[model samples]
Target: MSAAVHSERPALLVTAADLAPQALALLRDFDVVYAGKSPSDDDIARLCKTHNPEAIIVRYGKIGAQAMDAAPALRVISKHGSGTDTIDKVAAQARHIEVRAAVGANAAAVAEQALALLLACAKSVPHLNTRMHAGHWDKASHKSVELAGRTIGLVGLGAIGQRFARMALAMDMRVLGYDPYARDVPPGIEVVNDLDTVWREADAISLHCPLTEDNRGLINRDTLARCKRGVIVVNTARGGLIDEAALLDAIQSGQVSSAGLDSFADEPMAGGHPFQGHERIVLSPHIGGVTSDAYVKMGVASTENVLAVLRA
Candidate 1:
């Protein structure tokens, strides 16, 4: 007997960089259109129009109303990571498009990255290593700070923030978490709804909150002024959460001792961004959730989310 005739698979647009093969395997029945890494909203709109995809998987960059309008048949939008600010949920919801994120998929990885940055800042890892490589023993000049007795303030107490809090607690540090929307605070973390409390109490501050209009300049000069002198800062959240100019000024003025940054307001941080050549800053190219394991977990979750929506 002749084999059953196969039908053309529905199309899925993916914008992440070098998506995991396993994810594509999970989506074996779908025709995927991969936009290059960091595709603009306009790029998304254009791609959606050209491909006529039923769903879109955003790895990075914003998916706005324009992109949503471009795909008349678009049924769902999925994020590879937990953050949904990059996607215009209101616009998606207005048109009856469901939005899903790979929640908890990259939480551990992102938490680990935040901790790594915190440790690097506390111990002055980058500065020491750079000086050591330059043939300077500089140990006496740059002493490492101990994490055991310090207080860490977390701006968000979601999965990633909670994971990081546990790690910090294991190191004998005190954790203060500020999440206005969280239902319960994790064990060993002191929950504070007031932003001032976290800002005033923490020796080290790490941002894990989503970017929103209200919290965009959460860590500006005025906020930094409230923090302890020489307080270490780490951000694994959206870069726009902190005001760049204010952060730079604070760093220069010694209000902020050091910073560990993974996200930035303008990514691919242009040639003359102020953070460059700063000895006290540890900058990463936005790879907090880009670890190998996280990629697979996020990928699988993203693909499954799309399929769930499309098939439902």
Candidate 2:
């Protein structure tokens, strides 16, 4: 594509610095603007004002009312992944702008990550690995928890949750799920209507829910207190779902034996954050759904979502 030809196309702003080539091919008719990684609300608003894009693809950063108001031509906001909490839906609706998400596009990757985290927490993988690396092998004293025949409670039985349940069942584990909105839940998953049952019964708890006003800090001090003592916790979902301070306290007090976290209350989890260097907690940089395959899937899904509205 010639620079002159590209400049003549309708503009599309992407929050991320880069996009997959496969997804870019679908945007041939649009001139895409890359908002460098970690773009602030001010940067996004400035870009929207300068570019006057017809659509925005949200992959990172918060998309607030200011950004929406700046782009008078903006008609849609498409999420590059399933989570849409970062985008201001109320503001978009008020502005008559449509919001769409690449729902389930990254399900497999995130589900697999949840399972990995569960196993890491249950079997003490990181701790053992670190010990071995430091030339301190205490194989005789180390006792790993076995998952077979143990109950695993899952919150939010969406695509990702259901996928993780299937994996857990294959490993000879009991699967209990809690999701009021889920319908036709596959066989073998014991769906419990009450979250209290999940907290009391499960040996391990995994979160696969989205972040919302009603469910923010769902795993706070009170909820943690209700959980079975020494329970393993894994969260590949939104960080707001869990209270970071409560989780740390639970770990320190032995209410939660171990935790595997892929997301945080804040992204790029600031330097010297409390979660840093915690032995019982294993952390990942919110990349549970960031696999290469998931990247392309999410990118394509987000691009298609934008086109659905723009070309309607």
Candidate 3:
């Protein structure tokens, strides 16, 4: 832990203000640099130029080609969570740098968040709470949707999606899943070959897939139009999956009953964004995987991924 010894060690850059103590303890041999929260591409590039780190742990910002080029010694970019959409994979590949994700590290946390959002939307939790706070009880007139016999369509059957499916099944709800790459899906989930089947048959739809160019804006006007009327939508995965404008239109037209969104197409969704004041849309500032337990798990997983490549 001496300054001289730390200076002699290889550097590792973490794109976050702090990491879990458990993860930090594992990096005792490295000189770790902390990039303050909300670092931009230029800030990360500047840090890379200064530190010349052997590895980078992506937590809060996008890592571009410039940042990768700035660090000639960079061999790996490890994601602190499951999503790697923020990392420039093409640039990493071209530079012969490896990109790894702490897959399933935050599965439980994210799955729980998805469930919370789904339930909130189904039962009108937020709207009811607002009415209660304002002393305008309309309990006699208000009706909540029950979930026991409902069918929920899940997109992406990864660890997080599977976990949420189990929870939904426990509630006696039918589950329909659509994932082209998923194999050996758990029992009780009816796997559908196409998205059209999911949209047509499901009463509610939840997204749990990664953001990719092929699937960007997957839930758009056309897809929403195919869905059953008054269908509930919940997105706990990537923001780019849903077209915000189309979703707002669907909500306004009553084609979609309600929405629970954790991630947005743009991070730190600017003030006065269109989705801000909607009563039926519940929003969280992309904190689905930010629980204390998941934070420690992700940090440890990301650190281990870094060490794996560095020690290879």
Candidate 4:
């Protein structure tokens, strides 16, 4: 609830309170609502009913049709990150609300995180650390492979994937990509039309693809079976790209040697997930795009989009 005196300003609702000061300063002219940690969909709907926000800044939360129904004044939904899976696009379109994303703002951060995950999986960093913490130091048992001579396959060569390609190339790794619409790929990477070749050839495969109805579970049992035996998997993209159940089975059978995942299909993964406590898997909360620099850039872009739509 607001404690300050009232003034004439546009109502703006931010679904997260962790927005940087740079982004907050941009919203000085607007009456803002900040959803604290562990926010819920019910909170969003309740806030809209209480304050009637004309614009919403969505940062990693599920906002449904109920929230839209509560806020009849809402004109636009601006996502702080690139993905739109959290927001209900079909419902928003039905309500005639403009939904947009802060694209490319967090590309570098996400790309860097992707490489970190890939390296961590290849070196078994998490496993070694866990063993050491448990007072067991068997150094020679865990073998680390050199990344220089191996082939790395990228599912999508968008902004983040392009950056990952550069990093891999710097380490002398051969990078292959599969993106049907990307016309101008970077100089070093080879973009291929055939998807099977990536699964068959890549020593390690990283996913940078978006999640869609047609592409959901793109890495299912059939696709995982097609991969080279003992292949490593990395995903810094949306979770829906890989079927968690299928991946778990592959890992158990040694079909997939290791995995580094930052996103999952049913997110905010509950305790005792299939990947957790596994020596071959490294997991992170979906925070690849949570850097300070990305926050400011995304926040400013989202605010700008909101303002543009409102002022028009």
Candidate 5:
């Protein structure tokens, strides 16, 4: 028999940075290799060759074919969040590597943030807070619309989107969903065939789609023009789906009333970004899935996937 088929136990590599205490405890059970904050492809290659990990659990970084080539024995890869755009899934599948992620681990956190943004946009939250803190009582600027009896158009109706739909329904809001692959619409949601109709009809629009070449910058000037005037937008999913330049222009021109963004086109966003001082946009450093519960759930799921592949 060849040496390629002789390895017995599987080693695992974990490239996540600053793991919570509970996550660390669970990950410690495996024969694991670690790396600094953002390990380069070469660094990852070196580590994989040295450890020969059968599984790798990574977060928020690219894992291309080169990285996978470095570990000939790797059988599985686990992502810490729902978004898998960071990893090359096609390459992994070609290598017989099973890729898995915590599908709904951060659904509640994301839904909460979406609601917060919707309410803030409807009621002018940041604006009023600023005035109150500056010792000015201005009720005029605080006049806002209620969330009840409004339509919310959700682009993707996956796990997180379903959760948001339920929440919106509970708040007495009409939910409209547009997902080409969605098999069934929830009890309260109205499923639409095309996206342009949702863009024109919804009072608020929240995106939950993956970032792919087909949908990159889908929300451009033309789409913005189709959206209802003063439509509030929220994005807890990938950043490239919406054209940032078009969005900024809409916000300035009173087309897009407000936006809540958890992810950006470029993460660790550059220092002097235009949206930094904009009160109409609420930004949260890509922390939609950073809660302790999500961390534990992801750690457990990833560890389970690793162990399954190792035993196989």
Candidate 6:
């Protein structure tokens, strides 16, 4: 086959295997080449040799110095989601290649998913479903709590956290928030001064903070120890924020009632993963922002970010 032509508009290499067509349609002016599946680092380098795209969009997998070295002609990287942790920023900076993250585009969808997990965990939907499937009708024996009178503590008061607080208030749940960077907590949500304050006060705690070296594993055993005995935890944010082993141990010991995890430290968690058999945990295949609306928004936003850099 002839190599993908490098046109005047630009050639874009979409490294992600599952980018929606709508995202591609938005960038139709450019030549779009998709990797049949997620390409390995060497495969990406080989593709760069042939296609010579001006921009590359990556999702989920890491983009390291080796990948960058292979595509010196590449000017931009359009990250599909809010997180840029997987992209090698140091290499991009040194190479003078612009990198763009589609931040805030999927906050609403992700925050909504977090709340869904909290409610599902509290109501024991998975357990009830399993019972019904097993030829047992024990609905009457299972007790479920309502969110109306309970308290929800938000870990980060960023866009997603603030959005969650609004939803919680509408449900008549008390919302408490802790964010050192936030200027003021949203109206109707109580602003707490420290991380422990949220843990001690909340019946369900949702984490919405960014993952950084300092904040890695912030929700470890010690933090979980301070929470209410039956506190439901939701983390739609980055995976490194919670210590997976510590969380599993807490769940087994009944220190943590249940958890809703959208992101994991490792994606496509290996077969026979511990969480596979856990009924209490609500595990999404990182589909928090997998909605149609979020996909279009992120694509358009990243497109803009890319165009801005080229213009500059």
Candidate with the greatest lDDT versus the true structure = 3
In candidate 5, how many Å is residue 191 off?
A: 0.8
Candidate 6 off by > 4 Å: 1-9, 18-22, 183-185
Error of 1 at 212 (Å): 1.1
Candidate with more favorable, higher lDDT: 3 or 5: 3
What is the lDDT of every predicted structure here?
A: 0.88, 0.93, 0.94, 0.88, 0.81, 0.82
Give one digit per residue, the lDDT tens place, for model 1 in 1-312. 111223477778888556788888988887778777767777778888777778988887789899888889899999998999888888998999999999889999999999999999988888888888899997566568898989999998888999999999999999999898886776799998798998898999999889998888889988999999999999999999989899999999999999999999988799978899999899999999989999999999988999999889
Please report, as a residue range, the 10-residue window in candidate 3 with the lowest summed lDDT. 1-10
Superior candidate under lDDT, 1 versus 5: 1
Q: Which ten-residue region of model 5 has the weakest summed lDDT?
A: 1-10
How high is the lDDT of residue 300 in model 4? 85
User: On residues 202-269, what C-alpha lDDT tens digit does candidate 4 reach at each position?
Assistant: 99999988788978999999999999998899999999999999999999999999999999988789
Error of 3 at 282 (Å): 0.4
lDDT of 6 by residue, 1-312 (tens): 225675677667777655666666667677777765656777776667777777888764577787778777789987887888778888989998888988788888888898888888988888888888899988677788788989999988888889899999999999999888887666998998888889898999898887888999999999999989988989998899999999998899888889989889887778888988898788888788878889888777777777677668
Clashing pairs in 1: none
lDDT of 3 at 277: 83
From the highest lDDT down, the ranking of the candidates is 3, 2, 1, 4, 6, 5
lDDT of 2 by residue, 126-242 (tens): 998999999998889989999999999999999899999999999999999999899989999999999999999999999998889999999999989999999999999999999
Clashing pairs in 3: none
Per-candidate clashes come to 0, 0, 0, 0, 0, 0
**Candidate 5 or 3, higher TM-score:** 3
Give one digit per residue, the lDDT tens place, for model 3 in 128-235.
999899999887999988999999999999999999999999999999999999988999999999999999999999999999999999999999999999999999
Q: Give lDDT tens digits, candidate 5, residues 58-138.
A: 874678888799899888888877778888999999999989876777778777777777777788788788888999998
Evaluated at residue 243, the lDDT of candidate 1 is: 92
Please give the RMSD to the true structure for each candidate, in Å. 4.0, 2.1, 2.1, 2.0, 4.1, 2.3
